[model samples]
Target: MINEPSAPTATHEFDLTTAPIESFTALQEARQEVFSSERAHDAFQRTIRGLQPTGPEGLRRGLGAWMIGDYEGACDALSAYASDDVASFTHANALMTLKRYVEAQPIFKRLAEKYPGEPKAQGGYAEACFEAALSEHGEHEIDAICEVYERELAAAGEGFADSAEGQYLAGRAAEVRRDWQLALDHFGKARELNPAMRRNLFHLGLRAERCGLDLEALVAYQQLASLAPVDLPAMMNLGMLLEDLGRDQEAAACYDVIARSRPMDRRARLYLSDAVAGMDMYYDEDQERKEDRLNQILRIPITDFELSVRARNCLNKMNIMTLGDLVKQTETELLSFKNFGETSLNEIKEILGSKSLRLGMGRQEAVLSIESTQQRYVSGENAEAMNRPILDLELSIRARRTVEYLGCLTFGDVIQHSEEELLGMPNFGVTSLTELKEKLTIFGLELKPRQ
Candidate 1:
């Protein structure tokens, strides 16, 4: 780590625009001192603004502007110095900041070829090519440029492996070639080398997700999202992963950032609303606890209760080994069993009566007698819509979770269930039902209606 260098003691010596740098070392030291702190930068900016330098007007003023974080001024001043190598390089760097990748590419390429031994020139050219490869309408030969990128990267070899930027360029080339695995590997290595590189972290998260590395993707996105000036893509992916992991509160926070930033993003808005609703969702713990105790009682072994040998033998033959199974049998069914006479029946009836249960009660409660009011599966007028994936509905979280839990991969499976059946799911509510109904309405479909 370089120590912070102190600013000049004299005000006159601080003017970067006028001071003729004596040597490479002096220029480097002066640049370091100027950038050491915000106060120093501001002071340098003020001094640079007040001086008239003796040199190529654009080169002197533009170089000073570039150093003090004034890209617009640098670009304006350097616009006329196309023939100067330093001006061309600085101009290309500023153009990159303004997202003029095509304009920057040739400039950096020229500089890289002219100064083959300079790592900075080569790195800049590689970056421009990578950015160009990513643009949808690149206005350049993306494949050709990617090939060039690969050649440069390969020439650097393991020497470049020691650099985060070199590995990142390799990943970008691999991505451009649709080599997902190689891209993932390079991006992962780049992230390990420099965790602070936002683009590297973003690509690492994306590649990890595509390769099914859920936990690693989650961590990568989390780190990127935590950094300043929130990255929209990172936030979106983090929210999705968090939602899938059932971290609704954290997921809501992520979606909320995107939703607030880009109000017109419908997907992000929907996700935010769903996550917030999930955070407020109700779970009937009391009802679940009561059902749990009831299930325990029902699961008790029939043999644990008092019974005549004949009764026990009859139950054993019928495979009615538990109180739950015994309850599922009606009197008529039990009577049909050979050797199960009145005394055995009376004894069984008495035992169940003591527990306030009757024969066939479990079966009665377990069966769904209501039939679908319409055809539930694909085969008719709405068959095409029914055959579509559940994702077509763009459902809110609770509804989607319930259907997914029920193994509904297509709308057909979802339509097979009644509104009450869906509402019975944990966290699924009337609002989700209404939202679902609205979406289905678009395709002229609805949940199976109950009679």
Candidate 2:
């Protein structure tokens, strides 16, 4: 490693545990600087790296970890002690940062109850409860948690309602209740009060977009995108809106920022690619839209269409779980299955035909079936059962598809398909394999062992 100068130290050594909350304002400003100034972020990281996460310096380490966006480290380091309420707040905030909302709730609640006059504690409790409420399954449970949020807001009264943060909170609550106009109004007011406020700006842009105030949404997103320490989701939403408005160059810049930050974000990369393609001299707008439409159609789940029980069962057994998957199967393949007769065959053909597709339109070359190389031809009563039509087995679509899609024509053919082969088909997961095995057990036969 190259030798480097020491990280810049603070003007004065301060202990977070004993310091007033405002003592953090300078560091908060500095943290923002880290994003805008390359060397500053590196220095911040270096300072954080020098701190130990255990022993006497653990609390500072946790705080440093948080500043550097290492929330997991902050959670672990901060949890070591109940040093002070400030430290506890840091630990709780870290938990919330990592989306451990349930764990953060009680901490915020205790802090809120203990320091009833402290706005941060109350806000933290309300925010934590609201977030936790969204993850709850039962409607009543969600309402109960939301009730706490309402109570906390009500307790804040008129003074809180007058503030920017209060308006932002109220905007979110309105959104939860699906009061779109109210959400937009509150978010707008919050934006006016504090244009620099991060969350308020994002929600304002989102709520404005929902309300069809495109210009307003665009303005909010532009302002947000200009701020330091980038919000990836906000940037993504901004890019989408820009693309919709034919601002491909600007959209590409937004995507480029996200792509650089997260190299693994395929969506960002794809968006960037498309945006860049828009600038190409020979770009075909109509062709791009047709391709997009085709992709959308190909992604349609099989469940979206109505089919007769027999047809549905056949498709399920064939592991053809989407419209695209159905188009990949030939008439011969469908008819070859003992139970998949002309009526079911006609049903699939008609659906695909309506969508300008035909059976086997996209079929890959046939692969050799595991059955073809595996078992001996049967004889006697066992042989008779083996010769029976696959439909006679009355197996689920999953089991049926698993066996037949690999050229299984009868009960004997089904048994010839190995465990691994059966589990390899589209939408035929392990659970389906287990069910197939259990159903086969009723007929006194099991699948060929895994290869």
Best model number under lDDT = 1
Candidate 2, residue 255: Cα displacement in angstroms equals 1.3
- Tens-digit lDDT track of model 2 for 337-382: 8688878877776776555555554321111111112233334446
RMSD of each: 25.1, 25.9
Candidate 1 lDDT score at position 220 = 90
> Clashing residue pairs, candidate 1?
none
Query: Which residue pairs collide, candidate 2?
Result: 316-397, 317-397, 317-401, 318-401
Question: In candidate 1, what residue range of length 10 has the lowest lDDT sum?
Answer: 366-375
State every prediction's TM-score relative to the real structure: 0.42, 0.54
lDDT of 1: 0.69
- The per-residue C-alpha lDDT of model 2 at residue 34 equals 48
